[model samples]
Target: MTNVLILGAHGQIARLATSQLLQETDHHLRLFLRQPERLTITDQAREEVVDGDVLDSAALTKAMAGIDVVYANLGNAKIEAQAKSVVAAMTKAGVKRLIWISTLGIYDEVPGAFGQWNHQMLDGGYLETYAAAAKVIEQSGLAYTIIRPAWLSNADTVSYELTQKGEPFKGTEVSRKSIADLVVKLINDPQQHIGESLGVNQPGTDGDKPSFY
Candidate 1:
């Protein structure tokens, strides 16, 4: 069982991923979040809840100590700083593997219908922000897997396909559960995705067309 640390544990994707990890896997989890009370975890004995913000380097350093891997599902805003702190903390703690959640079009790789819509929804360097973060991770000397999911959906069901580097994004929307599952998969076997950025999305879907009127 891997000793995994999940940053941004209160976020939607993080919550779902935690649920799956708890129910399906034997791995131990340390949930790092700003508000521990808001977490819906039932197995108190199985999870170590660290109430702190990612921006707090000291707290993060403390939380990351002695962990095997880190799964980051941080939001886009302030991602650069947050990632930097995580890297520093992990480095200090001697944790190496990092699984980071990003969005499609971070490299203008979004393809099909979804890519077009994502471009419109996320304007003004939203793509650039994540791309920059990925760039940092790539160069941080850490074994990392960057997952860029298509426009996220709250649907209860999840189905997805994985696209590796150089492949254009395909598909439409992805359930938060699906994203969570992917994270778990990585945690289960880090060797499969070390140092690679992959894309996930619903198949046969396209971007939401904009109205010119």
Candidate 2:
């Protein structure tokens, strides 16, 4: 079975992906997070839990050892440093595959007024760091697929669209379950979208802003 390391294991998207992985594949899971007790499932026949910060390379190295794939579902703010740490640890562990969860608008991929709003709202803060993290993964020489999801909701649908890198990012929102569906697809078939940074959104949700915003 493929051994996967999931950093930021307690994050909402990561948690959903974990559930999808558990239900859909027999892959072994290595869950790493700051608070071990926060994760809903601490022990399963095929799961291992490790407690530590994602910015800690030593901890990441230990967590990454013998891992076949790394799923980094980190948050913004310190994401650039976290990306660096994750890449370093993966290199140290000789792990070559990574699935990084980033947001749209970092590459100026978003279009129209939504793009304008996105830039004015996030460019200096989360967008800046998100771009930096994306650069790290692209330069790491690892087989990577960066997923840039639009504003996420806690919806349960699995339907979505993918705007391949270089395409104008379409739509303004996607369900968390859709992101998990795509992530699990990539985990099950790593050869599909290598070196691509994909923008994921629900097919008909394009707008100037997310519905809730």
Best by TM-score: 2
* Regions more than 4 Å wrong, model 1: 112-114, 207-213
Candidate 2's error at 128, in angstroms? Answer: 0.5
- Per-residue error for 136 in candidate 1, Å, reads 0.9
Which portions of model 2 show Cα errors greater than 4 Å? Answer: none
Could you tell me the C-alpha RMSD of candidate 2 in Å?
A: 1.1
Model 1 poorest ten-residue lDDT run: 204-213
Q: Compose the digit string of candidate 1's lDDT tens values, residues 1-213.
A: 888999989889998888888899888899998878998768877798999999999999999877998999897678988889988998888999999998878888876655666777786867778888888888899999999887678878878898987987777667788899899888888887898898887776554532221
Candidate 2, residues 81-173: lDDT per residue as tens digits? 999999899998899999999999879989999999989888668899999899999999999999999998998788899988889998999
Score each candidate by Cα lDDT: 0.84, 0.90
